[model samples]
Target chain A: MLIALLWYLGAVIFTWALGLFLLWRIEKSGVKRWGATGRLFTYK
Target chain B: MQWYIGAMALYAAFLIWTNVKSLKMAESASDFTAGGHRMGLLLGTGTTTATWVSVASVLGIPAFLYSDGAAAIIGWMAGWIFGGALIPIVGYKIRRPANPARTFPEFVRMRYDMFARRSFLQALIGVVMFIGYLFLVNIQATGFGIVFSSITGVDYKVAIFGFLIFIVITNVGGFWSVATTDTLNAAVIAIGCIAAAVTVLLSTGGLGNILDTLAVTTAPINEGGPALDPGVLLTPTGSFGSAALLSIFISNSLGTPSSPHWVARMLAPMNVKVAVLQIMANVVVLLVIWLPLIVMGLGAKALIPSLPEGVATDYVIPLLLQEHTPVLVAALTLVAICAAAVSTGNSMLLTCSTSLYYDVYLNLFGRTVSDRALKNWLRFIVFVVAVIAVVLAIDPLWFLAMGFTYVYGGFGATFSLTVFLGLYWKRMNRAGAYASIIVGFVAFIIATAADVPVPFVVAVSASAVACLIAVYATKPPPLESYEPFFEAEISESTKVAVERVLKLNPAQQSEAVEVRSV
Candidate 1:
């Protein structure tokens, strides 16, 4: 139970951090037509 | 029966409000379908989250958790987070100026070619999605019967009929109505789930006490190890195992983009930025709502030694809510559960109805259907489909989770590949598009019909492989024919959407448009 709980916590934190990091990079890359930051949210 | 009838009345009132509100706002076909692109941030977030969670998450996830333990919760969350991460990259990217298509079918036709192949692909997707969801659809109906019979003194048939009437009423409002109600439903689901989870967790003491009790009560049923082992719930890779998690993430992330029902909601977003933000917001909301149910399930196993045979596990949450919680909380929780079911049901009915009216009736027949006429047609279609679903719900044999997996998974694999490739790769032509659809549909059927070993994996994998092979085998469309479809950059509204959401300045945002034409 202890080992599985630790692993679950680690997986979640790492995945979220990784996703946010990718999001930051994608924002910086300006790969799409929108500006680096412009790609993040829908600014209606 | 009282609880069941109470749920029905509440749902019916919600439907009347939604339909009356929508009728006042709807002025054109676009308004009926996309709510005139004015849906706000909260509504967008709430509806998207609520609609996607469905009975699959509400019932299936908890049921699995009760049987398996905490590990199941981890596995389920892993799928949601991965799917959440993937959506912004693809779903948002596709909504730009170069291709502002409202529906998934339109995207396929534009990105690929508008011919026999794309049409066939769309029809195949429609059929599979409808059939795939039938299992859950029926289960939910059966659930209604069970809940009603247990709560009220009345017969089961009344509960079923009441549910059907509720389905028809909300469904009549089309996309506009569904979107509004979905937002309300999301709130209800979140509150209901949290309430149930908290009640169950407290009733059984803390997590430590629950585990302590489980330790003695649960012994290894077999040499296979502890029957109560929490490890079974956690897939390898810390969360759920990679393949299972990946299957979930890929299937859902891709599926939402290509789903006619979901993208139709996107069209109603006040702007592009709202759509992207809503997807992110949905991630948070889903976690909050689903996590508690998992905890409740695990707690249930510790408290109740064994699950009763022949009882559908999906009702476990409701059972706990009714058994353990105060009367008022139980009532609201029932509202929440019904909210979860009705929100998705409304969306499904609306999507199927719109497809019948716009894509099949008008487009195929080439009839110049008026907007008012189309709305009426959509209402009629909803009524017919609801009646059919109600009838199917009466049958006990319907398997909701597996059925949804085969049907929805197939659609996601086939259409997503076509949409992504067609948009980015100009080499894809009409012939290739047709080939991809034919191969995908046939492969899906073949994989599922024979109960071919590992149907989900086989069907999804087959469709994916067929798309690539078929594309490579076919000739490209003429360059001249494809050129008009390619715009140099995305639309201003779409760019504004990207810029605002991504928090980009005007000059920095221009970089995103660099590859628009290419």
Candidate 2:
């Protein structure tokens, strides 16, 4: 009953689009301003 | 064989180049473990997708699809994609601390230690991580051995040994090396898998012809096997039946986000936004790998009517590359499978070793051990575990995917709910956290021993119930415990406590972390 290529394809398209959407949000959040500036960890 | 060897040499050279480059970049112990928490979008996406494309994804899923037909794909896609959807939730919550933990044990210690000396808890976490991740390391070894042997026509036992060298090199330069090499591997995997899928479609005359062949074929997978099932491959339930199908879906859905290394990857990103963004980015890229795998799995069956009597179903994809596809396609796809193995092996090896050395060992002694000594200790453990894992996969007991059910289920039941609740539930006290793990782990053991159907689902459910009950029964956690996660500013005392743990101070309550003279 769950076997529908068309339906699975749609979900695929939606999630693909979702990834790009969130990525856009990240750009808007000023990714450049905070580039790799997180506090670092060390063995010590 | 020459093509396979040539491509492998070139790939190995590039990987080594990255390894040497990363050696210099890992200045502190932190850089070794989490890439200095500086992973940008490209490397972040690459590592996530690479680690996610485990041997199980390439070999296991297709093996099931090869045998059981269309039903398997539905189960995997449903569970996996849904699990993929939750990455942001898990990532955002765990990365909440102003100075978040570099390792999983550190995260737990900070979050649930009333916000700071739970040695027993850390030890327990370490033990679980070691056992859980050991299975993962072994799974990679198993896949690497089979694929390498299949493509190169080498003995499985002999071929598997090369995996140890691969992992040691991958683990040598630490996380930066792992991420950089894995990024290269990820691109190769994506290209290889897609090419294999397109070739399969062309060979089978398209999906319609495949379904038609599967509809009436009663050919047994092995010689002289039960030859009675016709039209079952196209049937909704297929050969596996509905119960087994549902179980596959449930385990994957519950297990993916709950997998410790996946959450650990989130900690490596530049910030919480990057953490969330990486997973969101993963949805598109990971799907690129997953869709083709589904095609290759079913298409392999259509191309090769039935395998030899003794051959394992895991050989489906490798066999497709060897005989049916064009020389270039075969070489690339097989290399892709190899890439998947190395990609996963690097991370799992790191996690498994860290659990043993950092989490369990340091917690048992004390937190005062210097990072310099511990780094040496960690590398030693990586080599030791690689050898042990190779030993563990000596003989194939069942299909590759079958083993995942136990380990993933164990992790899911034991740690999944506790991790989730720890992140979201401010009321979740230490007692509740303890109860969840003890009860959840015990439930998984009992359910697995009892031969319960989809044991993970039952155990996770039990864990959830226990977690809730214990949290209410115990006293609420102090402001320190809940504040760092919920409030914008961490209390000064909590901040000092974090600094102490990070600095590796000798503990008063616990034993000293002195590396005593041998």
Weakest 10 consecutive residues, lDDT, candidate 1 chain B?
A: B509-518
Can you list the residue pairs that collide in candidate 2? A41-B30, A42-B30, A43-B371
For candidate 1, the docking band is acceptable
Residue-wise C-alpha lDDT for candidate 2, range B37-120, written one tens digit per residue? 667777888988899888888998889888887776666665666667666667656766666677787677766763334367
Docking class of 2: incorrect
Best by DockQ: 1
Q: What is each predicted model's overall lDDT from 0 to 1? A: 0.58, 0.75
List, in order, the clash count of every candidate structure: 32, 3
lDDT for B468 (candidate 2): 85
Return the top candidate by TM-score: 2
